[model samples]
Target chain A: MDLILTPNITDPDGFYARLIAAHDGLSDEESAALNARLILVLANQIGNAAVLEQALALAQVGK
Target chain B: MLNDRYSLAFKLYPYERSSDQDAAQPVRHPVVIVGGGPIGIATALDLGQQGIPVLVLDDHEGIGMGSRAICFAKRTLEIADRYGCGRPMVEKGVVWNLGKVFHEDRQIYDFNLLPEAGHKYPAFINLQQPYFERFMVERVRELQATGTPIEIRGKNRLDAIEVRDDHVVLDIMTPEGPYRIEADWLIGCDGASSPLRGMMGLDFEGRVFQDSFLIADIRMHNDDFPTERWFWFEPTHGAGASTLLHKQPDDVWRVDFQIGWNVDRKEEMKEENIRRRLDAFLGEGLGYDIVWSSIYTFQCRRMKRFRHGRVLFAGDSAHQVSPFGARGANSGMQDVDNLGWKLGLVLKEQAPESLMDSYDTERCFAADENILNSSRSTDFITPKSKISHTFRNAVLQLAEKHAFARPLVNSGRLSLPCVYDNGPLNGEDALPEAPARTRPGAPCPDAPLADGFVLDRLGGDFVLLTIDADAPEQLDVGGIALRRVKLSVNDDATGALAERYLGGATSAVLLIRPDQHVAARWAAFDESAVRRAVGHACGKE
Candidate 1:
């Protein structure tokens, strides 16, 4: 399956606000955990281990 | 020992005032509810309020003995609000949304469930289940007083169920003797360890939790602890296991201690052992009096199917989850919310019987979601495997220093409403660029309407939310109620409704089902479009 590479999110600001809202009032460590859980949730939705590995590699390249 | 709440033996009042079962006269009704708990009575109230005749059978007489299942979520309160039984619960219940999580006596993080509120109800109410059940029971009684044709037959235990082609025959054991009654539809709200489930030869299958926990509600006159949920993982006081504390109404504080699995269950429940443990766990001297105490083992299990020919199951009979997330009774209430209206419409011949299939499909999906979250929470708290324990500890360690790791620390992901995405009952999403929230197959997000909340406008009918446009004068609902209201830009003072539902569309029409789930949306109204959407929502298409 191909990855979603296009700019798909219509309202980026709104989406970001919701993402921040989900982690609002959480401490920095808690925020990190929330991000980890979010990544895990997305990875599970992705389901393909190869795609997950490739995505992890891509995410690591920028960092 | 029975707690103070159950010591008086609540007046049962002989609900079945008269019975023809001993005479072997099989009385028929539209619906037969087989449990008298909160879930059962809530379903009966919802159905009875809609003019659907129902007969409820319960083995016990009055409210449950102890304060079990105290936390009621906002979505459940909304469902109860629809039936006029939720207000008293909210008034008397302790409302709280902030939850504080700690790791070994160090404060880690806190969460606000509802950051901003445009909705009618708060995020949750820490009310005892018996009080909520009593409210629903009184609502049913009020409906009965109004001649809505409902029978609450206490002590009429369901001994046997004979599921025929189109109806159900129930053998109920009454105070005098054995008798039978037939019903067009049978609902088993009979809780976990449901006799009805066993009678039907069905199995509750899933992971069996090994660890045991002691839950106690104690009455103390301390005002130091605020109204919030406090959770500790491996506290010095708790001796390595997790603990949860909450302040309930009537100066009662609910405390949970994760005692190990190998301990003697009965001996652990003894007052002496309980007092000894509480002294160690709470750190407060012997001032507080224990109001109720019970031991429980967690399990994340559910029935394979919610519907069986003419017999159906709701609440614990259909699904059972650990008590961490407050999902048990809340999900049970949502079960009735999904089934009640469809059953009412089907009985009235307004909607096809096939609509009930959507209940099975959507609710089973929700049950799976609840099971998954609950299972994950139990694993995080207990961590059976070595690697799992290492990962959990690392997350907790990292959570103290970084914000991202904080979300990984799950004390118990408090209950949230399920969004039924892409279900069979959802009408087509014909309008492109529509908002994500009010998309087809999702519960309509609560918004501020004039003088009330959005859910306050929805119930007992298909509501068409027309924005900046006049409601169509002519549309057929096929004997089912259809409500059409026009909300102008001025009507939504806060603009939360417009931002969620109408994203720059001058005139958008949304078709919502009776359960307040979005069935379809169109940029413009068309008679045939509405007819088709209604057909699909009613499961006729």
Candidate 2:
């Protein structure tokens, strides 16, 4: 199972706004905790281990 | 019975007047090493044993007090073994390979540094810096007694130096009076606060972490604590933020407390205050006497260039790192190992002067590697920002339950010798099928031979190590002779040599440098290729 790197989300800006709105009323630590849980949830959804590893490597690149 | 800086282990080289001090004209020596610390003395031993005349000058008469650098890594021992002084150190040192890490009051994980067998030395030995120096100094004395051209003058301090195109003229201050001497080559092993570096108007460039650690070496007989490194983060004992405990030789233990910055250093140094903290940490029942104590703030820094004209710096004189990893003295020993052969070859006119530049190149690269690892360890140990602290704690918390996060928990990554992978002196790494541990530019991994170890056969000269392979008995390339050390799998009783050297391949040929770094290797012997590698290693290519 390959990661869908292309524009897969039909409402990209709407999803990003929703992601930001999730942390709107939270403190930095609370926001960080939320992000961590969200990452785990999203990671579980993308259950393919190799694809997740590749995604991690790609995300870490050029930082 | 507290031993301070004035405490002496061996007053080996007391103040003695030399005839050269009364010479009408300043006497010129082949090589003069400043600061008779471990690095300086090791450099002298390396050069002196190679039939090179070297002089060592030190301000102090002998080893200073305290177990300053108590952790001697295997590589350092291996290098010392090459100079014929490792056995005493290992005999007198407290050897340990296990380290247990704790988060708050709970043990998160433990690590064994060397899990496998067949290596000559242990993972690490906790010997006091004074003992380490004494062993090397004893070796120096033995060499001198055997008529090796090595002279050590205690109380002879280097006051000033004049650097020229080919030589260095140094003015000395002694208990008697002032004297002058010149050197064809000068080495600055003067340590972290290098007087020679200051005399040359040079300074290190890097980060200074805003934290201080207090090291207390106490003589205590405690049956509860095993001979292993035990570290605690956010220790529940009402001590400092973090604490370290290790066993040394002679019923001594070194305890380090990570006292935060912006505190009165003098107040912290007071014995009553120190004991107040220690008593809280160790509890009241334990009886112990303070052997030595010192406060240290580390900096991960290095000189811009290790080599400046005729002057060369090794050890702390060249670079410094946080003591977290034991990289400080271990890396300095490596610098001596690297520079000794290069400098020897240049002095003998066997290798080009450009080969000396590779010392700067390789060691500066190594220094940066040390600085990077130590700096990262420091950052992890003492997180600067709140987010970093949160992440650090998070990693520790997760490491308690998850194996994946255990690797991320950095409680000072132990010192390992740096591989000069991209070294300019490295030749073709043709043994792609062989073990990467024995690849070109990597330090030769020790393996058990039938009677002894593989590392014992190498060092001090070019060795053409061929395992289950055929090569010429010897090859002389550009006046440098490569002696062949032929070994077969049948000779390897434990099969470690075969596994470490050959891997999947049946045969291997490796050209090892005098420093025991693999210059190049092949699946089979090839004369021209070996010659090319030797030439390349000598900076002729």
Candidate 3:
């Protein structure tokens, strides 16, 4: 299953940025796996199908 | 009992020839503060900075142990900045703008603290409390270095306190000998079990939870965790199940585990018991030594009143909270911040002593709100009944799906600062009815100035903010020192400036106090009303 993650400006950026920054140091496969996990976790958090759809669209555009 | 661990050497003067000589000897400083802990030191520092002579008495030969309060809020930093400690604190501290909330191994929400860049200071910084104290002590020493005459009497203990209307007499037992000193004011910054508060017959009213938490400082080598705070709710640990991991300086981590109250008091804090909990979380084979470990029960309480006569209560002596929200130390520092400048003003006779009453009114409001939020958070985490457990689970489940539920579910209430709506100092004409987005009573929200520094960075004393000039000359608010800045009246800049300094505003004039709370604000400058409000707040009228 595919999942998407959307970052909000109001949410604390320090924690999220640090997490992403740490992920940058990982190997591509490791980073991809972690990203997939994060997307699933965030998608589970959002719960709304429309919001998830928007997040997925944004995720694909980034890719 | 006064061995190497607690020895003192005193210089004694030769005995006088007559009783008249002893009687004629010059009096020492009126007030002598005992304990160089943050509270004691802060009181002495504020008094000394106000040109009042003070002798700080401490038993320890040097500073205390461990990091203690590593999280410095923007408001606390602003207060420290006033005594020339803020810059050094900001310099040495690690600025963090985010925190991640986790449910066991799953990440529920991530918060970005750096929402807008215009504020002078960041949301918070992680700095060891000892170093922060050292910075404050150095500032105190610098004042003395200039021959300002503030003395820190270490290796001394308080034997007795005698309260007199004209002065507070202290019987201090030093290495030299027993001595008597007197002071016009006495402040207790002596922690939760403050002797001074007890001496004044002030009752600390609040609840102490039965559950105890063990805090362990460990050197972590985890690659997955970021250099940010992580809270794991209902972790698969012991009977009481939550874990808090916070990043500190020097690659150290402060982790807290909630253990139920039923454990044997003697054996519950043992290394074996601690290791068992650590093993449950980190799994086997992760080698790390616990630098420090201690267990403490959480208390949610505040003194009925912060002041009685010239004696004032600050920090833990005045109020306390569960460590669940990290509000305890931060709130204490805020008490010092609120009381420090006012004490300075009153000591200098610039403001009436009645202004001191606002400290009780304002700080009590802050303390109560902090306790309420922290207690609520504690209850949510440690649900007491099956119904509460179900409610909590349902909220979490809803938070996973609803954007509207995220703030409540993620416990953002803990992070939001309290506003003083019903404060005696707040005026009816002031923007009291402003929405939460544009609240008039809160500490000015941090925002970036066009000059690149944050607006909050300009704090440490009263600030005059002039958002726009529908009538610039009409902006005169008497009795309050005003600094005026003109920005676009109706534009995004107004929103940005409003959010930064006063939350949200189209055009207004704001008078910000030293503690960063909005002392008075006007939708548009009505000079006389502003002056009257300032007069009312400062007790000049």
Candidate 4:
């Protein structure tokens, strides 16, 4: 797979809450570390290098 | 009822009494079309020019007033050209190829739809829907003068239809009274609110957007705006959430404002309210007359099947999409283009009735594609959720300086011809290295030939086109003659023909259909393979 940018989430609000709760009691440095680790895990799960590169490029667009 | 703005411009088809009214029994015709709109008239022109007698019944005496569906794509013009009426449309239209997108009054990026061209028509033209219909009706009248056997009865409305296995019985309501008529086949182009579809008890299902847009066409003598499509998202003028501006002919401009979902439609369409919005967007004291205004809400929906027994549906009666990409009328013309020849063949006994099934399969596929695209554009333009809105704004802001994010900023994808990727009528595709744009199940792209254009000669019949490839001058398979058109890449002044038709292959042979879609293509011509592909295209295999 390719990067699917459409609205594919089944429960967006619930996922958002869960994501926010993950950083609950962590320092700023810990929260940044957690975000880094999360990105790596998802990228590894995707597996395809081209798709990972596309996601990387898209994430860096506004920067 | 047509508004008093502009209805008496041309009474193209006046209500005239026909001898069929006084007939002892119901008169049986080969084909009867309901709706004198562009699609119905184009279908009539297609069938009548092929010597098929057609009768068109319309509720109105002439075209209704409105500049609805202004952007006609290139493929639509090409199809109209084959119907002998593309000249006036292209001539009278205000052609536009450039589009600019702005985010909150800051110009982000711009695009040119036709950067390189060796084609006959532009990427798109902005023409009012009424003029488009009037030109086609004029073509019908011209063909009638030469006795082509196409009759359009004004003020004739289809009250009900009885679909039979072999024919359809129609009850038409005229001003004088109602009359009964029998048709071998009935075509419904009666538009989105199709009475024929309603009477048949069909399901038209899809997504309805929770948004509304107000269209105000104004007339003023000024050169303030260029002939380009300009779109803005959350304008600084606070006109609306989003807005679009386009220039049409005769000093008229089409302005569309995305008025939010929960508003009084009547209050929004008031003259003073419209003027307020226009004044904010265009600046005060512009001094323009409101030619016409309407508030519209769109849905991305379509029927389950375009064909049901003897009655078939073309145009908006069968499908609909948000007017974002201008896919409504353009796709409808393509439906007529695809169905016209297949229906013609079935009527002539040259092809089996099963051929009509391909029309349903292919046009439905096209409708789904159109719906998916327009829906995506709508979601981008009008974000439903907060997170989605943030993403949209971020994409737009990044698009100003970042090339990578430019394609992500979706104002509207714009209308393009749909390719039947997995259509049932498609045959073998042996030219693996050939350009995918000219491969099987794709509409043939036009190229400038020595005489004129490639599309000018390919449509209206089966063409066996050979480029640096050897094939018979003519091939007759299953009573269908495939005329050979031999041409070389040297015939073109530019090398666009070779680039579009042949990628790396030295020679190519393409079997083109009557609608100018590539049925099959091969590196070399094999008589048996050609015959089988021809048979397959005719629904004989």
In the range A1-63, model 2's lDDT, one tens digit per residue, is 776554355443235335545665677888789979999999999999999997687555523
Query: Model 1: per-residue lDDT, tens digit, B1-541?
Result: 1122233225453545454654556887779999888888888888888888888888767776778888998889989988888899999899877788888868877777665568788878898777888888778778778798777887777888888999988887766777778999999998998999999899789999889999888887566667888888988775339888887878788889898788788888888888877787667564788899998887899999999888889999999998878899999988998999889889989888888888999999999989877876787788765445655776677566555556566666778767788788888787777688888878877889778877787765788878776667446678755678667667778988878888766667889888888899998888788888888899887
The docking category that best describes candidate 1 is incorrect
Model 2 pairs in collision: none
Q: Which digits, one per residue and each the tens of the lDDT, describe model 4 over residues B68-98? A: 9998999999999998999999999998878
Instruction: For candidate 3, write residues B1-541 as lDDT tens digits.
Output: 3232422222111122222114444254545665677767776776676677776766555566676667777766666766667788888887666777766556777767554554566667777777778888888878888876577766565667777765677665555566566677777777787766766667998997878788888876664557877777776544248787787776777888778777676786788877788877767777777867777887899999887777777888889887656686678777776777787667666678888898888889989888877777777677655445544565555455544445555342444556888777765435543445434456666554554443434445555566664544323343334555455534335355555434444556676666667767677767677667666666676
lDDT of 2 by residue, B385-426 (tens): 665676678767756655555666666767889899989999
The parts of candidate 1 lying over 4 Å away from their true place are A1-63, B1-9, B13-17, B22-24, B284-286
Give the DockQ (C-alpha) for candidate 1.
0.04
The DockQ assigned to candidate 2 is: 0.05
Residue B492 in model 3: shift from native, Å?
10
Judged by DockQ relative to the true structure, which candidate is superior, 2 or 3?
Answer: 2
The TM-score that candidate 4 achieves is: 0.91
Give the candidates in order of DockQ, highest first.
4, 2, 1, 3
What ranges in model 2 sit over 4 Å off? A1-63, B1-7, B221-224
